[model samples]
Target: MASPLEEKTVARLVAAATAAPSMHNAQPWRFRFLTGERVVLLHADLERAMPRSDPDNRALHIGCGAALFNLRVASVHAGLAPRTRLVPEPEDPLLLAAVHLAGPAERAPDPDLARLYPAIRQRHTSRHPFADKDVPEDVRATLREAAAREGAELLFPGPWHADTVLELVRDAESRDVMDPAANEDLVRWTRLGPEADTAVDGVPEYAFGPRKRDGKAPVRDFTGRRPVADRGSTSFERTAHLALLSTPGDGPADWLRAGQALERVLLEATLADLATSLTSHALEDRDLRLLARDPGSGTGQVQMVLRLGYGPRGPATPRRPVADVLDVV
Candidate 1:
């Protein structure tokens, strides 16, 4: 067994883990550090779940998986080797993962994972527009490698396939506009006016990015027809740099792997000086999600649609205090 670690050290690791992105910035995860075993437990906070938007809890698993990945990265950065097991307890569905943090004497830290530590806090979802420029082939290859490391595939769609995916996103958006029930989750999670200034979880009005003026990027406009002060309209890139992240399976374990792959890709993109945004609006609908898959192979379930380019990086959004999410026992 590994020696016990300081609670403050564990709290810092949990803080970095919580920095991972979620469906709507919900931060739907809790961490428990078992001092005796030197293990950290990641659990899903069902209260933070979205039923209408993500009825099956696929996105929930993905978000928690991202947190798990961050915990591993933070551990490596802090001279600990993290051994992670997803869904360790078959009986408990919500017990997402268990990570044993071993000291360097037991297992050496992964240098590659440690290199990504800087990007953890640097990586933010940029809802703003990206410049019209092609991401270099080398950078794309690097991103693909990052995803593959976590047992996922990252595919950059060609022009025709990109157009098909955009159409599906628009179709999903129109459906959201028509369905009042669909907007319920949006209203509850979006912070406007004074709430944006103090809210710890959920997407703030400022992070919504500008309303799409004349671009084809599938950036979600959180405001809809509602008005916000000083929020101006801006034109986004005509052709978005879109990458589809997919896994071989469609189960809870696969969702967790996809989440890890998603964050890995995001972190690598961040280090590459690329601003990233996620478009899951289309993936929210089961049929539209199926249509968003790679047209070439017609295999692998699509988990996320990532937009990458050079533009203004988004501001850091709020996160729940580490004290609120971490418990040491």
Candidate 2:
């Protein structure tokens, strides 16, 4: 039998898990460590769910899944083997996953996961403009492999497809501007002025990056109509480097898998010295999501659109304290 895990160790793991990214940095997840069972349960904090933007809770599941992936990486780094089960209990829909933390004696640590340990803390979303340069084919392959390991697909759209995805994102942006209801979640989740400095969660104004003076990138403008001090405008890349992450199905399970894959790819990209940012604008709506998929092979459901390049990495966003998001049982 594996030895009991120390409470501090569990806390450390949960801390690392919370570092995972979520839409607007909402960090919509809670952790429960069952001491007797030697398992950590990931739960969705539905209170943080963006009902106006994500009524189906798909983004919520994806955020929780990213947290779960971080837990696995943290466990591996701590010399533990994390055996994970997704949605183990059908009756408990909010219980996204249960990770059994087996000691090193029971199972060997995964080197792949262990190698990614450093990137966990180093990775940050770069919303600023990336250099107008190509991400070499080799680095792209590594990112694709990272997504595949988590049961998802990553594809770099050609010029035409990329243009289509960007247009869809613009359409989503227009819809948000006209639809007051759609911007409710954005208003709630964005931190402005003094609030940005002290808030424990949400996207801070400092991390909002510059307004796109000229660029095809689909970066979300968090400062919608609201004025922000010291915010400037700059030219982003004329030709944005966008990649699409997709799954075979469009269900809860698929969303979770896509989330894991999304983080994995992000971590890998960070390690490869590539600055990255995510664009879920187009994927927010079912209709636009379908249009974002590869027209040549319209098979999978597009879950995320990632922008990669060489540029300034965005500052680390705030996260809720571990005590606020974790429970022991």
Candidate 3:
């Protein structure tokens, strides 16, 4: 028989899982611990889904997958091997993943996952400007290896390709301005004024970073052109260090794999003392996604565009309480 997992241990793992980044900091995931089975079920909270921005729920699934990855890491760090089964029940669509914590005999943690534990909290989506310095070739290789380990590809685009991706972001930003529905998510998930200080979920105004007075970093302007109190405007990096993450196919499973790869790369970047941010806005549109892919290597579907550099890390955003997102069953 499996040993009974402690409530405190389960809570710690859930807290670490919640720290994973989400689109607009929505943090759209819930956890249910099956004490008898030594398993935890990860479910997507559809209520947090962005109907306008992420209509097909791809981003939602990616966010939940990220949380699931974190849980595995936390479990390993706590001296338990996490044997995860993705989409364990297709009939129950909300159930995105189920992780079985290995019992006493099989509880040796994976050193790889355990080493990344400290970076879970350190990783943040830095929307601010980054320096013009290029990421060293060695670091680039390390990041690529990290993604490959999780069954995804990470490409540091060459100048010409990077410019093409940048243009796609510009086009997406322009479209966002004219499309009324597109702004719905930004409004719903952004916290302003005093709400920024107290709200437990959503991107606070302070975390919005500075407005793009100039330059092209592809950071989304969450203020929706309404002007934020005490917000400043500054020029971003003219040549933002951008990396594209892709998978062999475009399906729910591929998206989950991409998410795990995404977190792995982010944690490695954080450990390397690099600041990072994500921009899925450009990939929101189907046409834009097609354009965002590498012209030379047109094989995989692009899932996320990451901005990396040396700069001040972002402030810790709020997350829902563990009780709010977990249940003991």
lDDT, model 3: 0.91
Worst-scoring 10-residue span by lDDT in model 1 = 1-10
> Which residue runs of candidate 3 sit more than 4 Å off their true CA positions?
none
The CA lDDT of each predicted structure is 0.93, 0.92, 0.91
Q: By summed lDDT, which 10 consecutive residues of candidate 3 come out lowest?
A: 101-110
Estimate, for each residue in 225-250, the C-alpha lDDT of model 2 and write its tens digit.
99998899999999899999999998
Clashes in each model (backbone N, CA, C under 3 Å)?
0, 0, 0
Tell me, by lDDT, which candidate is best. Answer: 1
Candidate 2 achieves a global lDDT of: 0.92
Runs off by more than 4 Å, candidate 2: none
RMSD of each: 0.8, 0.7, 1.0
**Which structure is stronger by lDDT: 1 or 2?**
1
lDDT-superior candidate, 1 or 3: 1
